[model samples]
Target: MAGLSTPKQKISALIITYNEMGYIEKCIDSVSFADEIIVVDSYSKDGTYEYLMNHPKVKVIQNPFENFTAQKSFTLKQASNDWILFLDADEVVSKALQMEIVETINNPNACEAYWFYRKFMFKNSTLNFSGWQTDKNHRLFRKSKAQFTDRKIVHETLEVDGKSCILKEKLTHYCYKNYEDYKGKMLRYGQLKAKEDFYKEKHFNYVLMLIKPLWKFFNHYILRLGILDGKKGVTICYLNALGVLERYRELKRLEKKNELAYYLVMP
Candidate 1:
């Protein structure tokens, strides 16, 4: 055990979970390299909390359901470790990533906060196409140095106060179990995004409704080589198109209301 580095600073793994019973155990089991693991559960009705109770290193915090940003910030505050590795219930740290975490801490002239390139797995295929492969997330950082941006809606990235490095390791994301789940989540996210647009006076525009979605599909499926993924590729593109259509339709209805309000005020 001579080479076994006990390490000086404590690294805590932080995860925010809801009904993640199915994936929680495996996700926590994979990141056991850390000194402590914190699970902030939103009072799930499933076996998630119970499982965490039985888990050796798992520390469960019961908080009522809140937005993602607030929940994560709250958990970060509870962290006893100097550095925190943020993980989702559905995300798993690969072996390479685990080593990267340890080495990054052991080495800071080397890192401020580390970013992970996610490989989104859809069904049996590791989707290299579909704008997803280009997506990178900040999954590791010092607790005091980074914070999740306070956005009411989804698609938020963690804002770090210092310089960062991109880890060469890939973090596997088991996001969206099946096509139905993917479709449902996309539609829900579209509605949330549309609402944000509505508040910002970003109501229906001819270009957005008609052009932007088509561009997204073409960019992902055609130009991005999603066609290589075949059926899954086509499905991902079509779903993007559909989500856009739904968002546009939602915005269009609000646009008409704005026009009507303007006319009423004029008279």
Candidate 2:
């Protein structure tokens, strides 16, 4: 009894969604290897909930939409197990990744959290370089050591207090449906980012707004060797630059509104 290792630990695969009918099935199927699957839907009107209603292994809960960090944190609390594997609706865990995840949780080492490399695919092409080549996310973690940061609205950070590990297998990300879809998401993300910064009392500087976007394009495309990935690489860099521009524009708009309100009240 003293020499034996601890028993295999079960994992709870957690996903948060809102009107993700198209991608939900594939996402869930990828993580079927997990002991339990918990989906916290934000009242999806597009039949996303109905599809998961009869699943035996899945436990679905309908909750209202909140910020990204809050929604994810709430889902973490609903998990029945200590281990959590968070997945976005549009992403798919490969078979190799599934096996690796099973192995890691079954006999976890000293690490309390693990990071996975994400491979982004657009259309039929997978961009291997475009500054996204090094994209790794902290998805698998022990619930006791991990929590989401509340400071940001768009991209939330997972704070893990213990040692971490990285797996070589990748999680396939079907990020954008089309160029239009990509632009739409960028616009929304930019606005949310601007609001997040504005609420933090970050002042919007006119000079930095113009310089930052241009520098972003140059740094990602030229300095990061994104130029080698060809057309998709260029597109990715350009869109990233555009997102920076939009964020500053939105921030300026909010500042102007507040200034006008102050003047009106003073007179």
Clashes of each: 0, 0
Which lDDT value does model 1 have at 159?
A: 84
Give lDDT tens digits, candidate 2, residues 225-257.
889878887888888889999999999998899
lDDT of 1 by residue, 51-138 (tens): 9988988999999855566788788899898788889898889888898788888773756698889987775458777778678888
Kindly report which residue stretches of model 2 are placed more than 4 angstroms away from their true locations once superposed.
1-5, 108-110, 261-267
- Give all TM-scores, in the order shown: 0.83, 0.91
Every candidate's lDDT? 0.81, 0.87
Q: Candidate 2 deviates by what RMSD?
A: 2.3
Off by over 4 Å in 1: 1-7, 249-267
Give the 10-residue window scoring lowest on summed lDDT in candidate 1.
1-10
For model 2, give the 10-residue run with minimal summed lDDT. Answer: 102-111
Which model scores highest in TM-score?
2
